[model samples]
Target: MFTRFSPYWLWGLLSIFPIFWTYLVLASSNPSIVHILVHPSGEWAARLLIFTLMITPLSMFFKNSALVRWMRRNRRYFGVASFAYAAMHTVFYVADKGSLAQVLDELPRLYILTGWLAFAIFVPLAATSVDFAVRKMGRHWKALQRWVYVSAVLTLVHWASLNDWNSPLGAVVHFTPLVVLEGYRIRHHFAMRMKRTA
Candidate 1:
């Protein structure tokens, strides 16, 4: 059975795993599990971002955007998944501390405000991810989604704030790859534009 058709089962399974796992872990955890669960959410966000970034490079290498059709189809879903994690992380912070006002008051101290802001940006982007919203926003939808870039940066900041030593070496390691990926994307776009002009 495994030899018969691997592609259909493999990619399809991997793509949907995040969604299933998110809900599954959320439901299965005990009351003390809130912290552990939030960790997965942050990690999931990073994983989803990396997955989305991989799409273009994979398409380029394969010489076929069709290879990444499933990724394109589920980009919004992974994005929303990331937002779900971030939101849950926020909820944990608020709930554990007890009181929205206290959380808001201490927000600056924990630097959770950065995470809050990043999640806030994700809200509208996720809300308007559908075709109807794109049509309604006209050309503005793309610009609005550009907030993801800002959200990504803020996410790194939020992660950095959680560090005890402010070293954030791991965050730098995570972010540097994305910086390189974006650089490649920019260069690729420019080269394409130049080729078109030529």
Candidate 2:
């Protein structure tokens, strides 16, 4: 079944289509719908980041090395899409607020501050994503790339802390997969260390 199609591009396209579709649906709705669209679009980007992050862990745990190959090949696309949605989110927010002055007014607010930090964190990660940039940055590349994890956590924080922490539905829905993926990576890393010592 996997042989019939190109895994990376084909699957990635399938994964991302719903995001654009949702954006269109939201755009066609109420004038105040931009916030709704941006939030979920940003969430989808986080989810894709999880999907990209999960590929290696899944491949390792299941002993399917090809999955890692396919995922790594498309990892850049995931990062790129994450940036794209984030950009859309910023645009929506700016448009929704009407002007720079209005946006500046919201800047001191917690929701705006949290989201601003998350998007600010993503900008550099996206910029340094290419092969040439990575090679040039050397060890700094890995350090800078860890910003994705920060962005992911900040994304959830931005959403969860918006109204109240008691609203666990949104956090649970998004954070669960991230927790699982991180757990798997922890186990995989420990196992590798154990093997080296053995």
The candidate that achieves the highest lDDT relative to the unseen native structure: 2
Task: Compute the lDDT for candidate 2.
Answer: 0.74
Candidate 1 backbone collisions, by pair: none
TM-score of 1: 0.74
Give the true-structure RMSD of model 2.
Answer: 3.4
Candidate 2: stretches off by over 4 Å: 1-30, 191-198
- Colliding residue pairs in candidate 2: none
Query: Mind giving the per-residue lDDT tens digits that candidate 1 earns over 134-166?
Result: 899999998998888888888778777776537
Compose the digit string of candidate 2's lDDT tens values, residues 95-165.
Answer: 76778999998888766788899899989998988899999999999998888888877777777776656
The whole-model lDDT of each prediction reads 0.69, 0.74
Model 1 lowest lDDT segment of ten: 1-10
User: Least lDDT summed over 10 consecutive residues: which range in candidate 2?
Assistant: 1-10
